[model samples]
Target chain A: MRARIVDKNDILKIVDILRKDHEVIAPFQGRGRDSFFDVVTDANRDQVKMHLHNPYYPPKRYVLPHIEKLFDIDQAKMDVKAAYVEPKRAIFGIRSCDVHGIYHLDRFYLGRDYKDPYYERLRRGLFLVNVVCTDKELDIDNGCFCMCANTGPASTEHFDLQLMDLGDVYMAVAGSPKGEALFADPIFKRGDDSHVQRRRSILNEVRKHFKLAVNWYSAAVRYITTGQVPEELWAQVGNRCLECGACTYLCPACTCFTVADRKVDGKVVERVRLWDSCALSGFTRMAGGHNPRRAVHDRRNRRFFRKLAHYFVQRELSMACVGCGRCIDVCHGDIGMPSVVEIIRRGCAGKENDSTIIKR
Target chain B: MTQPSSNDKNIYLPKVAILDRVQDEIQEVKTFFWHFENPADQEEFKKFRPGQFAQVSIFSQGEFPASLPPSPTEKETFFTVRTVGSVTSGLHQLKAGDKFAVRGPYGNGFPMEQYYGRNLVFVAGGIGLIPLRSCIIYALANRDRYKKIQVFYGSRSPRELMYTQNLREWEKIEGFEFYTTVDRGDADWKGNVGVVGSLFKKPDVKVPVENTTAFVCGPPIMFRFVIKDLKDMGFHDRDIVSTLERYMKCGVGKCGHCCIGMAYVCTDGPVFTYEQIKKLGEDI
Candidate 1:
């Protein structure tokens, strides 16, 4: 990795350099506490906040959009044409946890036997600029548990460039060749060993600020892997779920989607794919009305099993829950990952040797 | 930004297939015989094994997973679809020359070659016989590789029976044993008038339990009752095989609709033994 230093005010110069060849997207503060990632144009480039709360809506939509067109079918000609788009875009000011989310998506979509062309296209064009969460006042949310998930305040890799704020000057570390290429710019200066030391001390100081730190992550993983969690605990968790699918939609690692075909005109039909969730009963329901996971509790159990089970963790080579805590912010009920881990820990406290009953 | 062209090997892209003919099997069920319009795709698809399935796309309706009913030894590729949903209904409206698209021969298919020199029993109820038809025809085509083969099929009534043409042909074969039953018999019907399980109890019919592999496919109730009968007859759980059905969007394993516990039914199996199915911890 190559290191450089830039003046605090010159952080916008980095965005300006990226916007020359890419459509730069950075976070902006919204009404009250709301913040979102939007395209940086000439007019609103100054509004791109350097310090703000991480957006509840993940940046995964950039790679896997909410609704994506798969193909277009010409009915009269009986021809199917694939709808493929790959825009040269850079997601600036992305947090560490969200960067891990994209890595997990990479392991899932491109690391498999059958590669998803749509996901691959968007992913190839992506340039990630991860911003470290060093400011306790603006960056750290009460619900964030990235410390427990071992993803942040600064990720080790997967981002093209990483920027950390250090009061007087910003320390920029290049993680890839694309990032190192920006070091030739006049705004960036050669960094010394002192900048590295400051980054470590600042990260150590900010690590103590997270309010929700889940210590029972490994224990929950063990219980879930061994199928030792009781049915009652899942039922209680499921009862609290409103089934709005907000948790899945906001979570950075959820990749399930359903496909549909719509008539664009009399002669053309478009096949589209939409993000889907396991919480919905209709997700697993067969056409004839036979649903394997008909009960809400069963669906809830699946969500946790897919996240923490050793089989899936081993298959993807990464945990599905990236500890971003977006699920906590979006969930109407208190059944987020940290809360669910606490429930499992308490439920299995004294029942280690007892026969575990998992109802289907 | 330049427009990205489609990849030639895109997994989601379904190859156009032209329908050669259509045969009405039962009241709502029809067998569509089709081949890929491209000779390369048709040649590549001929390697599919028994019990594998394909994702069929009917232009305006949607895509659905349908089992490949034709054996590799058979002269043509076809799907036996019962018009139960909008996708299948769209398929039913297509003429002989009409075109649709198909991808894969996905899922782990039945391991038929492993049952060499063993007696095979196929039990199917109604439309459940669709997937099993591929294996049965494959076994019959390579009869020298196996011993006694028996087929027991039942439907709700006389008109609901599937593959009547194949059923008639199997009855006349020398070594093959074919038996049919219905829940309720019609006025002109003369076959057994009971559940398919009743055929196992016929005095003249003998089911070899010593070295046999039983394939069961049907409604869940019939599956349960048939498993009980097979277990009572001293059949091991591993010796009984079945193909499962689930709502699937991707014939490949990316979509999570067909996942059960730890396994994706699309990739790990749509074909599983009774012992493996029990460990899935989900209902059929």
Candidate 2:
């Protein structure tokens, strides 16, 4: 089926239609430069930022929330019940990189050997309305590297309806059957070849807006896999790391959690899963006090190795990093993925020059 | 051996088990015998191997991974716990008939099939002997399938030693050499006085370095020293096996807390060979 062109007013009409059945979530400006996903009610309809800045936090919380209650235990009856809830909802104005992030999370959570029933329940009921990035200032910014990650400016697949801006009009393409159903109404019309050309030009323009170029990701992979990157460089990076855990918490693909039990009363107990970070000292601690990765540098080394090592990467079936570069902004030590790659690149080059000198 | 979530029920939803019996193993350590409240669940839960642990839940407190000290071959399933922190101390306060939730027989247990025909050497220190006791009992139960078995145990003092009753029985049993030692003996103590590695020096204890699989579980310092001694006496890393303990939330691989490098300790192992341990690239 051909892509369709829709006006801003018509896009709002689709949101109104979706709101009738599903809880529609759209990006809205949240204090200062920060933007977040919020439910679209009639009062807040005009506040939705159609042309966007990528939200400070990715939409992963919708699927794998911060505090998920796994089960409840009744002490008196000796019974346990699963606390699972699945809500039908649709998210509008999601950027391309975040869509890729969701796809990555799906591959890890559902596509893996064991499908998380909770994540699956929420994911299956959800609808996505992805918007292509066209505004350099609002959509593309200094901290984005989705071009290098091969996941952005526009997504090739995995969306319900992909909305693209054509200056005054928008080109809407159906990426799934659910997306195609929106076209049954007259709000969408068949898009021409001229619309396709316009999207390509807009994408090309946003690619140039990226502040820092990241040509080292794949190269760093080889050095990381071969175990040739010197320990000295990692130690230096470790020294700089404050272990604030902002990086992993901000990174869209970082999915570590810890389960905790709380006494609801004398009769019942609740078990909750909270977001966990590997950078913390106690992440690998055992009961009677034995910890692997106790050293700050060892833990620091672990994070990079897990993300870039060939075996781990192969297991995840995709590089853990989608290179959204959100880590760059959250990191206090300035030891985010892009910076780590640059340090590794420098170390690899230095080692090569040292080898050349020794041979001579 | 890599079971990435094989359970049919919600993996985190635990079965309520009643604490049937409790015994003080030492000053700080206690062994509690528990049975599933649902008789069918008890039958199902009894199918775990040695070295696997269960997540014990005391309602008011949290859950902790306690080593199943009793082997599957044993009639009762028990956990030998040391009161190290809140959850463990909470378990210590719980009496017989008190209810708690338990799920798992988690982590890859000791590879019993691989050690079937080899000479077995078990070394443990302090309350670290808890998990090792499961293997010793299992190996002795299936005696014909294995060769010579030697157990070397150590503790800070005579008072701190664990599982004295089991040690007494093994000492009298045929085809088994059991040696005990205390780092610093008391007035009534009359045993070898030194670390666990020192036991290997006794005339009766001939720890065959070759053609033997050594299983060591202890405090980090003891583990390091014992590993070094084994290396000096010539035991390949692959031939050495040990159960690792890591801070775990979900016994399933989903929680990244137990992760070290690429392997999740909760899934890939709480049981691993020394060769695998080195490759993990962490400070175990």
Best by lDDT: 1
TM-score, per-candidate, Cα-based: 0.96, 0.93
Q: Model 2, A101: alpha-carbon shift in Å? A: 2.0
Q: Each candidate: what lDDT?
A: 0.91, 0.83
lDDT, residue A350, candidate 2: 54
Model 1 TM-score (2 dp): 0.96
lDDT of 1 by residue, B1-284 (tens): 11134545688888889999999988888999999888878988999999999999998889899998889999899999988888999999998999998889899899988999999999999898999999999999999999999999999999898888888899999999999999999998999999999999999899999889999999999999999999999999999999999999997888889999888899888999999999887778
Question: DockQ score for model 2, please?
Answer: 0.55
Location of the lowest summed lDDT over 10 successive residues in candidate 1 chain A: A351-360
- Looking at model 2, the pairs that clash are A52-A138, A285-B247
lDDT of 1 at B210: 84
Q: Per-prediction RMSD in angstroms? A: 2.9, 3.5
What candidate 2 gets wrong by more than 4 Å, as runs, is A263-267, A285-291, A352-360, B1-8
Error of 1 at A264 (Å): 1.6
Tens digits of per-residue lDDT for model 2, A273-306: 8888888888777666667666788778888887
TM-score of chain A of each: 0.97, 0.94
Predicted complexes: DockQ each: 0.79, 0.55
The reply for model 1, stretches above 4 Å from the true place, is A354-360, B1-7
